[model samples]
Target: MMSAVVVAARAWIGTPYLHQASCKGAGADCLGLLRGVWREVVGAEPEAVPAYSPDWSEPARREDLAAAAGRWLSAESAMAPGVVLLFRMREAAVAKHMGILSVAGDAPKFVHAYSGHGVVESPLSLPWERRVVGLFRFPGH
Candidate 1:
């Protein structure tokens, strides 16, 4: 199951960043990447995502992304393979970035699609760890 998620995420590698998009081999944003993985690993999306701009939660300063994850996914105490992660870029910014923990160990890491980098696996380094605002698990089997 974990491998499935990783592989599915990797498939999005090189996809161009397109806000609110979620199609593999075309374009996708961070949340779209996670949504793609969710469909692959869990099933259809739990709910329809509303049209959101690139700066969806910045002005509101609400943890909208984290709140939505809490609504649809299970919480986990620590980083685990294949778990979803929500990040708050700044103290006052909303949690917008999303990723999946791909390696959980002494050297923890995750995979996310970024604007310029496309989909890539990254280390959950100090800066990244500090940004993590919430963690969630895929429910059911």
Candidate 2:
């Protein structure tokens, strides 16, 4: 079941980054990529997502993305395939970035739609591993 998410997420690789967009292959942001995967694996989005800016533009303590992910996904204590990773880009900033853990073994990796880089699966490097503030699993899995 978790692999299903990885499969779906991988299909979006090469998608150009587009803020507030969710159409795979066309464009998507980090949240958009997650939302698209959720729709494919979880049936439909639990709620509509309102427009929001990146961490740099948002207030330092405003954690809307984490709050929403908490509401729709089950919290997890450890990283696992298909689990969502929430990242706080910098100290004191909101956890505004998100990605699905695509690989969890020796060469851990995650699939995310990065600004300017689009949707790409990158190694779970130390810098990224450090900023992770929360881990969550899609409901029922």
Candidate 3:
């Protein structure tokens, strides 16, 4: 199941970044990428996502994304392939970015739809690790 999640995420590589969109090979933001993968691997979304802006939850200092993940995904502590990672871009900011872990071990990596780079695999380097605030697994996985 974990490998299947990784495969589904990798299939979204090269998708253009589009805020609020979730179509593979067309466009997707970080959340959209996750949503796309969920549709492929986990069946329909559990709930509808409300419209959001780029500066989501920042002004209000709310962890909207993390809250949603908590409701629908199983929280986990250990890092492993297929886990969803939520990151805080900066100190004192709400976690808003997310990715699916694709590779674990020495050269750990993750797949995400970066704003400028679109969907791509990135090294889970120290910098990225430091930003991770929450880890989760797909429901029933």
Each model's lDDT comes to 0.84, 0.89, 0.94
Instruction: Give lDDT for model 2.
Output: 0.89
Which candidate should be chosen as best, given TM-score against the real structure?
3
Range of the 10 consecutive residues with the lowest summed lDDT in candidate 3: 1-10
The TM-score, computed over Cα atoms with residue i paired to residue i, of candidate 2 is 0.94
What is the full ranking by TM-score, best candidate first? 3, 2, 1
RMSD over all Cα atoms, model 2: 1.6
Tens-digit per-residue lDDT, 13-130, candidate 2:
9999999999999999999999999999888888998877654346556678888988998999988888899998888777889999999988899999999899999999999999
Q: By lDDT, who's the top model here?
A: 3
Cα lDDT tens digits for candidate 1, 55-132? 886777766788889899898887778778888877778888999888889999888988888778899999999999
Candidate number with the higher lDDT (1 or 3): 3
Off by over 4 Å in 2: 55-57
TM-score of each: 0.91, 0.94, 0.97
Task: Give the CA lDDT, 0 to 100, for residue 74 in model 3.
Answer: 94
The per-prediction CA RMSD against the true structure, in angstroms, equals 1.6, 1.6, 1.1
